[model samples]
Target: MTAVTKIFHDRLQVILDNHVAEVRLDHAERHNCMDVAMIDALLEAQVWLAERVGVRAVVLLGEGESFCSGLDVAAVVSTPERIAWLLQPDATGMTPAQRLALGWRDVGGPVVAALHGHVFGAGLQMALAADIRIVHPEASLALPEIEWGLVADMGVSVSGAALRQDVIHDMMLTGRHLSGEEAVILGLASRLDEDPREGGRELAQSLALRSPRAVAAARRLRREAPAMSERECLERESGLQRNLIGGPEQREATRARLEGRRPRLA
Candidate 1:
């Protein structure tokens, strides 16, 4: 049976079904723009998902016309308390605003984002945090913070590390928009889909059927490989494989493959 949970007054809705959790950003009237309240909700939602080891996959979506139109600057800057909350740093020197993107990394499962319409500034950064991004061909993505005399500070440096320096420079300097197809070509998005939400959900559902332990290990390896030496990566890969060789999930996977049956992993 599926379970649904709403938190932060439904600004964030989490639907957990068959080990796949769909997190919906529900502030539709403003294209799900990140207001102070919405930011709080997202931060909380990420923290909530981080604690759930059973969640094999996560699909991030936004309600209504757009995935997200980026930050509501007027709303965020007008509130003193919210400003303080956004700026306050944790032990690692990461602010709550920064956490909005990087916190998704704490979730123990692969995250897939379904993006459409305007995915601008912080919205683009948030989508970039996802392991896979499914975007509508017509979706507009931009790094518009430069237009406001601000840098893209919501963990853009960390999340966009793999992007070409020239491509990053062009978007940041020009504050121009890129369509979903162009984004895919530039390596900003995983793929373009006619219905990104459905595509994201289908992908997440398929990932949920895999052995969670193996999936988690692979996810970690993918995240770490870029930073590790080739020798270190090989050693790490071998160590992880050794740990899984005789594990319950591994045995189950082997048994199911041989029997031509779906795996019932723990």
Candidate 2:
């Protein structure tokens, strides 16, 4: 194993090792709830990760009992200036709050979110942005924004499209809590595990063994296929394949298979 590099942000801790980065929310005393600082840290972390092409996989988890308890409503509402900053739109017309969740999608490669305990509102939206979600069977998952007199605005409009319309509507309208098992059955979660953090780490480590280029291509194809026409989809698929077919990583993968050895992909 390689030595890990740990970077601490305002309310987050990022550990980088051998192409896998663990992004842990560190405000455990408050169930790792998203206050202004936490949200800022999240967005900042994404910016950091975006520049590191060596980071092939990311495992997103919380430090303590819960992954996140969603936004700290009273805290945000108390500071008028913070609210304005949170809602400030960037060049893409996406508010900081929206990017805090959606930015994970653009962070170079795959993101595997480990969900346990309280995963609500903004927290769930953040998880939904990940390519894979490993959820604890007993973890509580909910939209919970309706109860706070707000809609699910943390990029749920984009990520929630992967889920069933009825299920999305029910969760959005009622703010009802669902178990992680139910979440998987309802298509909100990828899978259920007793220990989501460990599961996520295992999955991420496995992903790290593959070529980052291939992994990124797969993620891009999956994400963009929905909106593309069939002809465009096929063209995109072939284009991506052509880019990868004669690459060094692909050749190394072929050699490793022929040699019956594990691929040491970079």
Candidate 3:
């Protein structure tokens, strides 16, 4: 029996297809903005994915024209206590905002984000947490927190996007937006495609076919090594390589390469 439950809440959808799970932000009328309810749905989804041992890849995409448009200011401000609640950590020891932004990453599998339209603030943070990002040309991303006299807090500091200090400062100070093409050029996006959703699925499928162990290890190294010193990073890399070089997954990968065919390893 499948261990994962099919959840279709008001603001989110969790659907598993084969080994690739798709988590969709579905509140399109509000540009799929992150509110308290959606955040809770995402938290539940993180646990769902974490418990599903058969899932090899995760694809996060929005339901409408936009992937996400950051927080719902009107909704958030309407509730006085909600703002304070966003800062409270759940059972996962992660704040609500952090859990929503980084939940997909917590799953021990590759996460691919397909972005289009407005990818702002928390949306961009989610993309940053993704191991691979595929964005459409028309997508526009921004950190508009400064305009609202707020910081783009949502645990965005650990984002793996290769943005320079100057670029980060400029965007944060001005709340400026970046196009999808520019995002790719600036290393915020892995690649640009006409149909980002399809592209994300293709990338996730490719990852799902690979050895999950190797994929997870590489993702961890890429996602976390930036915070380490050069020497520490190098040592970690070598240690991971040594641990993987002769492992079952590596051996299967090698055999598949030698046979000139797709690997059939589990």
Candidate 4:
């Protein structure tokens, strides 16, 4: 296990290995609650990975037992200062949760989330953003924002469309949590594992073994399959490569391979 650096004290830790990076929610003391600072750090990690070189896969996980409990109720209710900060716009001029959720789509590589314990509210949104999710057999997944007198945001509408409408409605409307087996049955999770971390790492390595170009192309296809026309999707493919080929990150990646060194960000 490589020593991942913690980007921010109030946020999480990120570890970049040969061709894989892992983002771990580090707020275990509070069940990895979604506070303003954690949201900012999550978005920053995505932006960093977007520009990263030689990275073919990413794993999203929580540092401790539970994946994430949800929004920090104390931060939202007891602390006006914290709530004010969360309401502030991010660098992309998006709300903190919006940035954190949408940023995953911008990351160039495939992301697989290793979910365990409780994954509720905004945490479920984060998990939904990943290309694949391998959840623990005992894990609980839910969307409880509606119970809090707020509509679900954080790109849930777009991403949740991938899951069955009935399943999505069941979780979103009633705030009911689904077990890993139930999630898989409902098409909410791709796989169930006894140990999500090991399963996630194995999947990441498998994905890393494939051609980076092909992986990226497949990601593009999957992301655009819903709303984009065939012609639009083809154009998107060309546009993505146009931005990547001969790019700074690609150059660094090639150089790193030849030099037998970890690729350094430009």
lDDT of each: 0.89, 0.90, 0.83, 0.80
Candidates 1 and 4, the one with greater TM-score:
1
Which residue pairs of candidate 2 clash? Answer: none
Q: What is the lDDT of residue 144 in candidate 4?
A: 90
Please give the distance, in angstroms, between residue 108's alpha carbon in candidate 3 and its true position after superposition. Answer: 1.9
- Supply every candidate's count of residue pairs whose N, Cα or C atoms clash at under 3 angstroms: 0, 0, 0, 0
> Model 4, residue 15: what's the lDDT?
80
Find the candidate with the highest lDDT and give its number. Answer: 2
- Write one digit per residue (lDDT tens) for candidate 2, span 107-158: 7669999999999989999999899999999999999999878899888888
The sequence of per-residue lDDT tens digits that candidate 1 reaches over residues 50-155 is 8766888999999999999999999888988887888799999998888999888887689999999999988899998889999999999999999999889888
- TM-scores for the candidates: 0.95, 0.95, 0.92, 0.80
Worst 10-residue lDDT window, candidate 2: 1-10
Candidate 1 similarity to native, TM-score: 0.95
- At residue 73, candidate 3 shows an lDDT of 83
Tens-place lDDT per residue, model 4, 183-235, is 88888889999999889988987787655765777787787878988898788
For candidate 1, the C-alpha RMSD (Å) to the true structure equals 1.5
lDDT of candidate 1? 0.89
